[model samples]
Target: MEILQVIILGLCLGFVYALMVSGLTLIFGVMRIVNLAHPILIISGAFVSYWLFILFGLDPILSVPAAALTVALLGVLLYKLIFEKNAAQQTYSEMTVLLTFGTAMVIDGLLAFLFHNTQRTASPAYATDAIFIGDIFIPLAQLYSGMVSLGIIVVLALFLKYSEFGIAIRATSQNRTSAELVGVNVKFVCLISFAIGCALAGSAGSLVSFVFSFFPSRHWEWIAILMSLVVLGGMGSLTGAVIGALVLSVVSSLVGAFYSPAWSTMVFFLALFLILIIRPRGLFGIRTD
Candidate 1:
């Protein structure tokens, strides 16, 4: 029963991680530039939620959309001021990597200055609530986060399949030049993709805050883990991100349960190294033009 509970808990956390990775994968798919600031954006979202909870007394779940909107706007501004102009240059990807990394450092510095290095966590009344099912206990916060993550995944999949902008985004990602030739606004698509990607990351951060402790500098750790997940999952595959998250989370949880918590992180990185060795392009590599 205890083992079963751990698996369930791990899967719940995995879903949230998958949601965050999906956003990173989406941006990579369309832009071919990994937003190194993704985790810092998440940290910003966490602060947003924290402020909302403290000021307005709103639930973290309810504050998610607000965080998402704020991050989305920031993403658009970033694209226009930085990424869009750089995209026209020959070294767009390399430039973006350095630019986003710099942006992350700036954010980290700002957060540290404002919030200090102390650990903080968002806790609503239901944070510690749990449900029991046949001797297995499921945390309410994790379950809620999982459901929201799954819903976001489903909505994203359907939107890509059905929405007009979604189709345009896909077309642009598949071939930017061809898409532009066919009258698709490639620039607009990239802007929207970046916004949506950051928004997803924001939402995931807000949701997970209910169950996780965070510090101003913790974004660095998360960025490393997320980068590993994104690469091992396949740089631009949403489903691959989900699979990678599940694999990593389950392994980590099991290791932590049987061994030490420190060993769990080691296990995750070891798995990532092994996966990359076996599949150079990741588990679900998509050929981009």
Candidate 2:
């Protein structure tokens, strides 16, 4: 029963993990540029939800769209100022990594300065409520967050499959030169892809704000853990990221429940190492090169 509870909890958390990694992987697939600053954008989203609640008394869930849209606009600005101006010959160049990593640091520092380094959670009364099943209990916040995560994933999937912009994004990711030659604005697609990716991150953050306690610096921990999921699933595969999240979240939860809390975090990186050794490209990862 305890193990079952743990698995249930893990899957619940996995829903949000899947949502978070989806954007990261999508951005990598389309641009061939890993957004190392992605985690901070999620944190920025969380702060947006946090402040909206603290200042205006809005529910965190209700704040998600506003946070997502805000980050989407910021994503536009970020691409224009950073990536657009410095289009390198090599997409995955060392300079791209440094630029994004530095940008992550800047966002982190600025957020810390403005919001302080203290831990916070958007804990409304409903967040504490739980539904009981026999001997197991599920928190309302996790359940709601999971539902919202699923909704967002479905919306994205539909967009990618049916929408014009979505088709363009897929074409560009599959082959940039061919896409450009065939009337797709490759640069514009890149910009839109980055924006959508960041918007997803921010929406995930809104869910995360209610489900977990976090500080501005938590991105360090999040990025490391998420990297494992991203790698385990493959860099650009949406399905892979979701599966990796479920597997890793379950593993981490089981390790924490059966072994110790401290070791739970190690499981993430360890999974990354083991997966890389077994399959250098990841379970479903295709080489972009």
Tens digits of per-residue lDDT, candidate 2, 207-254, equal 999898988899988989888899999988888898999899989999
Error of 1 at 98 (Å): 0.7
lDDT of 1 by residue, 201-248 (tens): 888888877778887788888887888888788888887888999889
lDDT against the true structure, per candidate, is 0.86, 0.89
Q: List the residue pairs that clash in candidate 1.
A: none
Using all chains and alpha carbons, the TM-scores for the candidates as numbered come to: 0.96, 0.97
Model 1 clashing-pair count: 0
Which structure among the candidates has the greatest lDDT? 2
- Please give the RMSD to the true structure for each candidate, in Å: 1.3, 1.2
